[model samples]
Target: MTDLDAALSDINASAEEDVYVPFEAPEQSELDQKINQYFEGVVVRKDLVKAVRGNAVVPGYVLEYLLGQYAASDDEATIQEGIDTVRSILAEHYVHRNMHMAVKSLIREKGRFRVIDRVTVSLNEKDDVYEASFENLQITKVVIDPDTVKANEKLLVGGVWCICDIEYVHNDSPGSVPWQLGSLKAIQIAGVDFDSYYQGRRSFSTDEWIDLLVQSIGLNPEQFTSRGKLIALTRLVPFVERNYNLVELGPKGTGKSHTFSEFSPNGALISGGEVTVAKLFVNNASGKIGLVGYWDCVAFDEFAANRKTDQNLVNIMKNYMANKVFNRGNIQLGAEASMAFIGNTSHTVPHMLKNSDLFDELPDSYRDSAWLDRIHHYIPGWEVSPIRSEMFSDGYGFVVDYLAEVLRSKRSEDFSDKYKAYFTLDSTVSTRDQDGIRKTFSGLMKLIHPNGEATEDEVRDLLEYSIEGRKRVKDQILRIDATMRDSPVRFRYSDQAGTWHEVTTVEERQYPQLYPRSWNAEAADASGSDLETYAPPIVNPDAASSRSVRSVAPPLPIVPQGGGAAVIPDDDEPLFEGIRDFKAGQKGVSYENLLLPYLVGATKIQIIDPYVRAWHQGRNLGDLIGLLALAKDPADEIEVTLVTGETDKPHQKHDQLLMLKSLKDAADAVGVVLRISLDNAKHDRSIATDQGWRILLGKGLDIWEKPSNPIADARQEFRQIKSDTTFTYARIPVS
Candidate 1:
């Protein structure tokens, strides 16, 4: 057989084997069933992307668009047929750069041939015609008509993935091109019915819909917390919100550039991190527009520190990012493209907050206050977990091309004022700060609740999340440029009942010793003692439980414009009576930092949480017992009792008891007595001690989500908080 024929045979055999695997299939989940029921023709199994994508290097959206046409079904036979069809189509038509010569020869032999490739158009003013360039076919200056360029204008800016037909003729004449473009089709959904999409969205609950969107992005929502899901969805804001400016910096391997590059065809990812003014904004010399005129989002990838950039480009960017308009040759032009900058961070968050600012990794040109102030939100990318093979979902989700079209349609709707009915920002927040929060909140609302409906509590959650994102940008600016600290900004909000709540970044709360209360020069110059330099001390668990220590001063309350009470931590006295609230997704919290202070001086303790039957919950009970073992003297024995509920199922109850019995034996080896009591009616979760302290637990031992990595999860402080809880302390009744 010929070499080309042999290659095709090997690909066919591999495709057949990869299409199906022999295994016991799990039962369909409720959400997956609902997805297929409601959006049957627009959903497909997410795992099918990898199975069918053997060597075809194309954007995910392109492949999904094809899959949705042939394989959007739950039936195994239908799915296999669709996969085989897609693989055959790719094998016959998709152009590989290395095999371009073969494809070109085939076109010449057949007089006309069809292939899938990325096509870009450029205006040849000298020739007074438009010429096309095929990326993988390695052909340039193929004669293309002006009407085709006008119909698909995105071809002029950063190119578009397309299926095009080429006609070639043998020509011996001098100075003549033989390549001809017959037709072209971009690989995207042509149109979507907005009314139908809006009505379909009402079929699912908010949580279910959010999970659908997360799965559409190819992530398993079961593995992420609510906050982590939000962080992942925030990357789509630039697509749905017009003229939005966002910045995200964190460690590598977090998939920061994946959405912009592969999620949507309307977004363009500039991998070089630097571009000339002519290509990005406008070309004054040629009187042509740039990427902003064609794409919905222009993302800069690998944008790090020390890259030289033109001052004129930065100036034009600041104006366009702020006002959504730019000046070119005395003419004003406006477009709806959003801006995003994503890069890697060399230092940890604490290290940056202590010695430098978070924006220290950005180029000096972008580090200007005026430029930075235009950013609407700063995603704490450190909170995002790195992408793993297991993180991808195998369940059904919407074909991304359809979802992209839906988001593009949503860009025209505005929901910025939806939060005003529930809460109000503090007067100390500047106009720019308010705009940032409003834009971020508006985008998230559209993504989560497209029906323009949300409860007061739900609106409050989005509002606080929005404020925290913008506050991270503003707080780092205070550290980057001291001159901007003259006008201090306080990030606080007031509820309808006049209760004030201050929003703080998680890193600020985690490392209070590194963060300052005030960023002004006078505060820093006054005394080094103003900011505590010591970390949270690890007290010897072998010491007696009755040890005493000096108490530190408490933080001040955040009063609103209208005088109102706010909660504060009571660190001034021993045996304090107050509640400390932790936000969701906050890290660096643990049993030692949270409970050890109050657990001191207690010889006997009772954990009243009733949900300690699962393996993770049993691990939590063991951790508490281990804490007691550390707080007491090595020779002394402290009695610890756990009151939990028993399962109704026979096998589950048997396993729960076996796990607890094993934990009890491990506790006895450390000089602590472990006792378990099972009650079917136990509900309230709390920890009571014989030393006049009753600590309320909001989420019991299940405050944290399941861990992803062993090394990080081994330490409590490194785990992300899955739920928000308040630990209220009060004196026992002494009955």
Candidate 2:
């Protein structure tokens, strides 16, 4: 076995003993007791599929079902035996469609045999019995009992891929056929006692419960930060609620459809093929219900690529997605299946919003404003990074089948009204708008707080997330449809007797050009004169803006310093803590980010770097002056002294003079004095200010890599680091 295979097999082993594990295990604590008590026999650890799934190209649920049958015990030896048993079963009994004759002969010889295959049941009105058909096996007209047919109505409409026993008997009587069902089992959860499940859920904290749910879906939640965790969990909304419609579009390899397709049996993940009205809604001539009537969730994978889509289908979809009811002939029909559309976008978030909108990724046929408005939530898939092996969980989580049942059982409960107790949303839009927010909120609550024991803060977090998700759809709809520009949907809410709180979508905050004239747009820019005049309305940057330290710099705390446009009351005031470290490939790094915070009130500043001698290096020095230009403090006559080693080249003196001349011109334009001197002995690099803050740099002014020309490609404000390097920043008190 490979290292990953060995590590996966040893997931149940003690952490110390299992040195091959690539990721950290979650803190089990008291939760393990609940995991063992209620979930022992019914569920299996999700990672076991990786342990035993070697060459078999089967779905995650397939491997999980086998593991559930064998390794459902807690004992190490028993689990190991069960793993081996499951592996053996897949190798021997699992049908290979390519070798159909061999499997058919085995079934005929054995009289009855179990095999994994897709089975769809149909009602025979003339015979008054249900007949089962196997897609891969090419078998049809096999009689299934009426009781089994009634118990699993999902089989009658959309064919379910299942594992069942196939029996063959040779009848002596004329016109008698012999293929019959010995037993049958649907791929999804048979049933779940939610009371017991809720009792078990109350054992863990909100964060712990959230992590457990993420792990149950086969992800290591710790790898994702809080925003990332929220984004990943939003994909599960469709499975937990009825008639929900969600869209996720971004770069590829983000596991956008993994949750819908292979994770559960109740969901159908289809490709972006030509969608006909009959295949999706109903076959009018045959009077058979389509996928919407049977499956709990139907996801359209690569949704943007369906160029040949019929306009009729889009029109029908728009109506059905909004009302959750459609007509087949004259018969009115309603179904509860949720809809998920996952696709890859060709343009970046900034690029799309500047020219068009995020919805531009879809083909023109399906980009109708009416069709787009029907969607309730728009998950920001661009925020999610591509899946890596380290993101896989090696901890205990529920088997996919078991979790599917739990989420489906939660559909009956509505948590939409639960938010009304703590907060009130603006009644600005039509019922459709309110329904969109409430359903998204309900779905998120069902996913994260199925037990209904969430704290007020936790509830608020989910509420904001739900609102932001729905806000993305609404904002984009306004861009697509001219009528929606005047729509009365306010992205604001209020707490009990508190001021109204407005929310902003992630992309809207990241690329403000899309929403150029927001109510708080001017307040977002916190630099120079703007900072002196206005303070940001929201304390938390994420409320409307993105990360607290993103493109929009926070107002520099004006304290007493000798010189600079900024001011403070007194020098005796205690200095507040200010320090930041940046990883490579990090964007939004500039001098305004590194030095501006420390040099706010300094009359004199020192720049020391040994290698600021080459032309590109001098250009970096010039860029530093440009940052000062952006900080244009006409009131403060600041003096900047550059101390660096001489360039050892023959014309070093001439080069140094020319570089200093350029720096002088740039600084003088910004109302500052620039001075330069050579120090051959200088080794370390740092910037010290008269205000008593030392900003140390491991790589000095050359912390960034060379940008290949055109400037826009390497603009550090939006550019990612191209190489691996280290830098440290610290502020020391001048005593």
Candidate 3:
């Protein structure tokens, strides 16, 4: 048998006998193996268990007790047996929808059996009187006297988990009856110590831990796509970072809410439009604590597009995000709980960038500069496509509960300095900008390159991407309000002798067809181009003094081309000659189809997209790399470099270098190279022949769909390959 088959067979054999012997088995006992097998690879159904067990909202152990039943073994018979046992336990002991009836039945049938329930109780120890309140069964204000019970004697009250008090009644009867009693153990259930659990499981590597989690959830890790793996990894970030505020705004049906609602005990999901200041922080009247106080991470589901939020609350949230301190009745308190906000966007990326920005649709309160500035990162929700059923994995992973705790313990460390040695940010950046950029940089750095050993280019790329992400937020604000000044966080050079340049956004450099102002209007207009005239309006300095009516220029006419821009069809296309020969000049297949299949395994790909040195091309290069990553295998190694002209900013080169470094590191983890080469050549777009076997043409690295409102679907149906675009492929003969 093959090595993989042998391994699988051994694993199956061990599992058949109710034992699991990992390749690197520790000194674990048979029971440990059984417990691991039971909990590993099973996703706990939190809502179902919560619905069944009333009165007490017990922690995850209760649900784990259930998952352990359904996911005990790989064997169907063994798993069925475990499920039967679990079902019996729940049916016999757990309170149901009719909690009062269920509790009553339990008390009558079992007589004195112990039960689990949430109870709120008040104690007057000195007076020997106590009052108890139950939530699920609706029992409230039940008074009990302690004097009737023996001093310091513990009694199981009502066969339920509780702390109570009892007192003797002076009556002319055969025996003294209990007059008063109190209980305190209402919230206490059989909770596994989280710290101990995490500590015990900390020895496993991240991959191993992730595998364990996937296995515990009963999903194989190998079946998941790269993006799927990333989505899964994101779930663990909350657990890894203390107070790690994460926002994943992606397409619908990506299972964004699954981890928060069903994965672990430490997480809670608050539905959209249901969050209030009191619920998030502290309630004044009842002195009841909020979600932040109770849960390690509070995820706001469907958090986007709420227009009716309170301004005061938004302001308070800004403070909380910036300082981690929120005010409660003139008191500022700190919390280590992380926050997550998820929402869906109605518009596509290109449309959003063209007309507004990612944050444009947000409510005015949330749109405040201070509030937006405090958000550490803004995930490109549109880029994360809807999850397909096929994306789930079949490999092993850690239980969600175990993974969450690992993330929690890892938050104290920072991995930012690993990149600091090779590169540095431009000095012109502000603290707010720096904070936004650095927080994102640091968070991602912590996530992947936690040891801070990332190369110079790796650090540079991440910094640039982080800066660009934050810029996407800032740029939209500008479109919404022209009064907002441009941010000074330019990606410039730190060295005395600058060798590189910067590109702030994709619109600034490439897609001159979209940005008329940046386009060379003379050249474009001379080609019988339908390009609109984009002359800057001359402002009359004295108009304000006399209130004179200024003459307005007539609207520029749009001359539409017959079939878009003219293209000179090549008779001798040497670039694609090699590809045509390999495919035997297949008539029906386009260049994209011919070349894309071979490009899938490439380790590094280079694209040369240059504009004015520091303004646009850098971003174009970065975006190209991102696209290549989408097409390539997640584990395949690759790198991309952009060769462009020098820019005017003294620090632009440094910023570009740093950006490249960050990208390199991110790519390295996922198997890609990110780099930049400076060249002053004016007109050239060619993919390096040495990096791989094929080259792309027609905007080389800048191919993008036309901007559309409400964003067109990303599926292959709506978008077709550019017919005029040229591509070349050549086989690099094996040495």
Candidate 4:
């Protein structure tokens, strides 16, 4: 065994080896080892969130603490049994918002029985005694030992949220309070053995470690392509590194704040309010630290700006975000918390590019160049799919408390310099730009290679990723604040051979308009704008490119705003017969552009795709109905027959029927009769119409993936298809 493996194995061996994991899945087995072999003793399976979680709403860190105590065993029965016990404890001892009176009665009847509640401690100067208050239980002025107050002073500030055991003493004794603190502990604490964490880290390869983290979040890495996996992993950055400023702006349902709110105890996902100086930084009137001082990460959800919020608050946050320190009166306080901004975009990528910058929706005050420069990374939340039920893994991972502690501990180390050996950053990069790159580099390194053992390729991938993230931040900044057009923030690096390498962000290459509006001005683009735009590049090489694309028709078709009838020209609405690219922020073309023309003038269309088994696939068919309504004559009836596969699994037939039936009913309401059939031998996916038009599709009826919401899905063009699949549209003249 490798030394790292032996070290991890030795630790596991030394502990009681009788622990068994439940559910016996391949993913579960991998999760079991990730905890024992790599993050041994320091990680917890997050799906345990569902098992132990009851009606009593509690933070994840608290349950993780309970899990680490009773359920941190490898034995399946032990884990299962532990979950039951934890559930029981929560039901009985944990305080519920509605059952506070009942819990109080239990404490009174039991003569100081222990119950779980949030305990905040403060000194009562008049009595010269320390007092504690239990949140939700509505109990206050409970006496606490001075040492207890001293040991957990976080309570004195914003009130450390915790699960505390309070004893209720009904005493007629004079000068004595009925409440007493039996036991007190913060809801979250991070105490990690960095040496052992590093030692265990040496055992796994880069891919293995990345997979472990992806699994830790209760997701299967195999489900996501490599780039998709990386996109998903970017959410973990704020957890591992301190004072890391990040933002993920995209459509809703992408689960942007899911990690901070649900996974770890140290992070908080607050509603993305316009910055408030008192809430985030400090409240000078109360002489208390704000969220920044207490939490490891503070994610702002629903974060799009209205351009009307208080500018002073925005300025204060900008300073804190950049410097990791905020001024409170005369005293300046430093905090270790990272900041994250998550929100949905109001406009389509193309609409924004043409009408406004990508950052246009942000509050005008927040769109300041000074603030954008502080962010280390910008995860394209657009790239992530809505969290479907299938995205979660049924596996074993460390109790979150263990992982939280490990991440908390690594905040002190600097992995930003680790990549310097293999590559040298260009001197032209600005200080803020360098800071952004280094912070991103440092966080990814700590996540994938905590032991600092990375091959040249691994290091370069991370480095390039780091630079790209920062570039996303900088590129948008220029578009938002034209004054920054002169900034020298080029991301260039050189290898040991002095072979200089320049990094171009994914958006930069695809959306070259940000540099010079004239770059693709004459090339035929997807937006179908008047300018001559060239077909953009495709991520999938097999997918054809429209490099030589030219507009066959001078005028673009204008369908009614809300799926109303379209005014077709005399010549078959000018069939779009050229290559079209939809990657990057490219606008205009969508499933509507691809499917509508061929779908026009056809009364019957048969969709042959085998994988229409899930709700999303069924929903894709539903959307096609909407498209059909737009192209319908309204006087002529339309027919759509679905030829999909039937799996042999139990309930498969029932589920497929139920889903298709719902779709069929909806299709009937729109002047269309929908047909469904079972086709076992169906391999190829295509759309055949009565007009002798047969269109070949790379992804079958699965051409359009799930968008952020139902509304976006209804508006076909608003949704972005991350998959690089091709579609061929051809019409045979009544053969």
Candidate 5:
């Protein structure tokens, strides 16, 4: 029997002996319980990997594969026993590079031993035989048969982590190899039943499934917003979506390469310069296939500006990424490998948007419009949080190997047209743009609604998100190539109700001044259509001008009104009085930006928020007071009154008062008079200024989540908005 067959048989034998019973945790979350109930044997506690992976440099799939075997149960005794077993196995059999001599000595003494090491095989032309090399053992020329190599072809490319059985034999004859490969099984899920996976998905709501999937990928779902969760999942699209080209550029340490490098065995992540046409597509001299033929996804890391790139490789890649085919000599070959490029951006999004296009950081050769257009989606990696200690999940999640297998099996299914039932893309969208949208929509549906069960709103959300991603790519392309401006692409969609929603990237809304004015003019000319727009008031970057005008668009919920230039108002004029919406996960928002412009002339301001009882709430109140101090003339003292709810507990109220007293002292130091009142009867939150404008706050001053690091959040824009908020301005009589 084959090694893989033997491994599957062993697993099946174990399954027969101990049929899986749904694990019941004593105090589990609803999502965790659902994950365990639907996929008991395939789920493992994510924290356990760190506990057992003391100094090991192995990927998560390798460690989780072992953990899933022994630690899948929720019972403490079983989990403990499993952890012990896994620890013992790794301690004894797992090969460490520094201790290879000891393992070799053990194998020689015992005549045969099993070791967990990465094994790579290559054809030795002179010997006319297939030879295997052990990664950690520092050994080569071990003979492996053709049948074994055929069964596991991945051993030829980047190598596969495996449980290997090796034997040492004394050799007296010349040219006789002493090392023997008895058996080898690649560390991966042997099989996945798609039917069971689909049925299991049916048991989960979309939100629950998204959380479960995020947890499986080793992230804390609670730390991410719904939009953030979708962006994170987009990284996995290349794995499940065939020939999908995705690029993510942002600051480092955002886990951009984590999914490709560690989440799945079916993916290969190499440095940008390490790739070549021969290594990626085909070797003309040897007639050997390359990485694309073996892996489902080929990802390039550190794919930023100023890297040396070969023109031939770029030309070949352009064709392969566009058509999924490349010419090797006289033969045309096709590969299903998706392409992912992840790099760090040297500048912030606004800087890039202002100085050059978003693709400005790419190497000169790759920044070509033809090459950039093939990208299916462009992820705004800046929106993703940097990896923090608390971001890693400790709860139960699918064993990554099982999840990988599920993603791989789904490539054959198509949900590309699912969005068409509810919405239609704008005619201005090109065929290529439509293709990118459909593929992204298909991949997201396969992930969130694999059973093809979704409400119209859910489908619309996915469709719009897909359009925004592709639109981000197109919008940047227009900036990079002036020639493309002749045929402008408008990213909009129409629902069955005949209402059009214009989709804009969150960054676009946040920095309207940085966006290209030419495209905004074209969009304005087309504004005759029924559209819903959520355009934030444009702020002039010139600090000398305190007056800014809001972009006028037809008011709607989801669709964007066409863009227009901001009409700069006089410095003495009041700021535009309108409602401004901020989405959750949006950054660059502060009390100074949201309200200070309107509070310019007010000497007295009354803030009414009933929920300011917590420590963070008090901090928010202090921040607003500081903004008020900035708004008032230095010669004039401003009076700020805060009306907030008080806790019933005596100790809590005492602590709150102490915090408020400290804030008052700080306010007094800045020439601001602070008055505090306990008001449990107030239900609404607003800021009333003596300057004739009343600003209604949907979420009050507590708009941001508690920052991971308060000092950093203040110095840098690291905190994301926790709640979707709106600031509605009403003209009240001057107090």
Candidate 6:
């Protein structure tokens, strides 16, 4: 075992309860391991059988019944024997309907046998009888006396779970019609008492609870990295929060719906298109309550596409989401149901941010401000990539049913006050606007920092991210409805005199460079009268010639063709040469090597780039910091300033500040003295580090492709570099 595994094992072993086990490979494949893990320790035999089947599209309880008859064991031999026995039972007595003769023969020969099937029932009170029906047997109108019905009411009826027995009663003569009398055994099958189980395990720490949950899902936590575990845990937040609406829009095959549908009885997951007003709210005709009234959380699967939703339904849903109540033919009912809307996105994050805001392709009705306002949090689904086989955990976690209750009960506690003393919102922000934002911010804080002792920087980060989520909703609504006024959402420092600033969505302030023409207003303004007065585009003949030439040309002679020998330019001035044909480690041409000369004694550097406002932009600065760390400095402090646009809002400013903080922290750790500043100047791509060191840049910060997979390698990759791929730097200086 690795050091991490050994450490985890030691921790688990020391726990009050057995929380983890050393990684052990099952005799079967990984798929089999999952099945065994789900069923091995469960008390119910039927559940074991169903888990082994692994989602074959059968009624869950029916599979459970089969599992109960077989495979309820930790022993491999017994499980194999049970599997064979269960298969034999299915082949012998279970009717497939297509094989009519086989079913008839089994009924006749077996005389009396138990078969798992769907059954329908109708009460015939007038006749003092109850009629039982079976689909597979093609049997209907079988009657049971009152006493027998009471005893066997739980038998299968149509799609419901029930237990019944058929008795053939001969009437008066041989060859006469035979009457079948079936007895109802029971009405509803009881699920495991999850509430009691949850209460029993409530005292476990969050990490312990997560481990138990992972084990309940039949995954080995060891297979997943810490970050992977956190991502998976984030999926559980919806279950833990009451009336908490969560939307996860990421790439497909991420197991987004697995926890809701398979892990708990309190949750329900329906297809995105299947949702209707009546199904979600109340049935007007019969007063039959819908999913929202029954399930704690109803997740809408595949809820992303713009074209696949009903406009009218979306309107009613908007109100339902906001008030937690819906109107159905004048009858109103309140519900505490939390909604989860999960979907798949076709475009990358940067691409989507450039084209439109995060909620760009949502249906018209769902795009309403009233509805979007109710959504507490917006998970950056794209940040969560598709699930791989390696991401599952081998560690133990709580059964989801238990965790759901913990979150529901903890709803009464508030954590927003944790930041009240340290920071505040800009005065222009309203209370109504802060409700949703603060609630979500507080909920996350409670989950992560329950004691309310989070540091100032941590509080600031969560607050900014939380505000950005709400801002995404509000901004999109403004685009849809011109009448909607902009909400003043900003964060401020309570102790500082002038720290308050307006918050803006990352898409609105930082994505212009990647998609310059997509912003409707900005594009319109630039395309109008401003174009004529704007400066003309500059071109370099040397750059143009380099693109056209296929082979390298020899250097020209010092002597001119019609004059005295030309004087070679002095190399004293640092010449910023943009590495057109640059590759890493070509003698002294790497990024690290190039920056060493400037660090020694160079002064007065200028960097011009338009896309350096985002998190990725901060990474470029980080890289420069690393290069500077290599320079020899004991008594000297290098002063570096940046030239870039001011971010459109305070949140962007916050992001920039955080980026600088990281740099500062790293520099301090290594004892490096560096000072950096930002400047707003319009110019072509170039940088002048120190006097006379000039570099002409191509593509500026908008070069390089985003890495396809971040977890694969460390170096020469975007993830390893700790910055966005939206930047490339070159050196240049004035002659």
Q: Per-residue lDDT for 86-173 in model 4, tens only?
A: 8778877888788889888887777666666666676787989888887888888888788877777667644656656667666798
TM-scores of all predicted structures? 0.71, 0.67, 0.52, 0.70, 0.71, 0.51
Q: Name the runs in model 4 displaced over 4 angstroms.
A: 1-31, 34-43, 122-130, 157-161, 171-177, 188-191, 305-308, 511-595, 598-735
Per-residue lDDT, model 3, residue 146, is 50
* Tens digit per residue, CA lDDT, model 6, 555-645: 2113333567644323233323333333222221223433333333443445666556677666765666555543422222345545555
Question: lDDT value for candidate 5?
Answer: 0.80
Report backbone clashes per prediction.
Answer: 1, 1, 88, 22, 5, 54
Collision pairs in model 2: 559-568
After TM-score superposition, the amount by which residue 465's alpha carbon in candidate 2 deviates from its true location, in angstroms, is 1.0
- RMSD of each candidate relative to the true structure: 16.4, 15.4, 19.7, 13.6, 15.4, 16.9
Question: Looking at candidate 2, what is the lDDT of residue 128?
Answer: 79
Of the two candidates 4 and 6, the one with more favorable TM-score, higher being better, is 4
Candidate 2's TM-score: 0.67
In terms of lDDT, the poorest run of 10 residues in model 3 is 549-558
2 or 6, which is superior by TM-score?
2
Give the Cα lDDT of each candidate: 0.80, 0.71, 0.48, 0.69, 0.80, 0.51
Backbone clashes, candidate 6 = 54
| Candidate 3 C-alpha lDDT tens digits along 431-501 | 76666666666666655454454556667766676666565555444445545544333544352245544
* lDDT: worst 10-residue window of model 1: 544-553
Judge candidate 4 at residue 132 and give its lDDT. Answer: 80
Preferred candidate (TM-score higher): 4 or 5: 5
Model 3 gets an lDDT of: 0.48
- Model 3: CA > 4 A from native: 1-62, 65-83, 98-100, 112-228, 242-244, 444-469, 481-483, 491-735
Write down the TM-score for model 1: 0.71
Indicate the TM-score of model 3.
0.52
